[model samples]
Target: MSKWTEIRDGMVSALDVSDVVESAKDQLITDLTGDGMDALSTVADKFITQVQVQAESEQGWCMVRDKFVLPLMINGILWAVKLVLAKSTPATATQPEAPTGDSQQ
Candidate 1:
């Protein structure tokens, strides 16, 4: 199971409603949901950071292996996807298009 799902299940299992009022239960649910969202946000942040690092490394590798068609294709696809994503969503910053040389084609 996913980390968020595990956290949610744990929270649900720990809730003691025998003596709690209905309003209190509602508050508890809201608090638990917030906690879950916080956890998810943390996980997402970490993933984005790792992806950024890996992408940088992949670019270096592509430079070294420029003659390989596979690397060029992979980089091209990544750039296209990034462009599509940036257009569909909000732009975090201006992202320049990936450089392509004659060897890439």
Candidate 2:
């Protein structure tokens, strides 16, 4: 894809990351309603707006337009990243284990 917008469009499909956006939205709503959260509810509202703005095709997340090298939707992006990291080593994340050798041949 020659255009940045095309790459952005294709990446969502190629990487199958569309669900991540939905997941983030759900998480935001959860945070908005849930108690004992570290931050205020209004932060979630701002993040939700950023997620919507980034998800829009017309917006398409451009640096020139949005002035972002880190992306305006970075909270959602970071949420997905944190999700991936959390899932990456579930066993180890929850419980400590001895550093062992590979099980497979």
Candidate 3:
């Protein structure tokens, strides 16, 4: 998935975070009802829009992208190192045969 999508999904799904957002919206509505119920809705809508805008910004995208891409890059580096070590060591030298001492004579 793209970085922004990952971030958006994370925000929507993890840690009861959406509840917090909803709670904040509810609080705003309660506090700002003097401007009328319609104004409260508009404020809530604007808040959501601003969150989306921030998530899609370059810095947010890069942070989310690194969360995924960094692990894959580390795995690739580890695999390459293992491959090089395996190639350097002879198989026979590494896996020694069991001793069959000449007791069968």
Question: Considering every candidate listed, which one attains the maximal TM-score?
Answer: 3
Residue 66 shift from truth in candidate 3, angstroms = 1.6
Any idea what lDDT model 2 has?
0.54
Please give the RMSD to the true structure for each candidate, in Å.
19.5, 18.1, 26.5
Model 2 clash pairs are none
* Weakest 10 consecutive residues of candidate 2 by summed lDDT: 32-41
Off by over 4 Å in 1: 1-29, 59-105
Write the number of the candidate with greater lDDT, choosing between 1 and 2.
1
Error of 1 at 75 (Å): 22
Model 3: per-residue Cα lDDT over 4-83, one tens digit each: 99999897787674456655655554444335434544654565455545556547666555444544555565556555
lDDT of 3: 0.56
Clashing pairs in 3: none
Clashes of each: 0, 0, 0
lDDT tens string, model 1, 1-105? 899999999988789457677666555545544574456556655655555555655766653454354445555655565455445432323456665766664
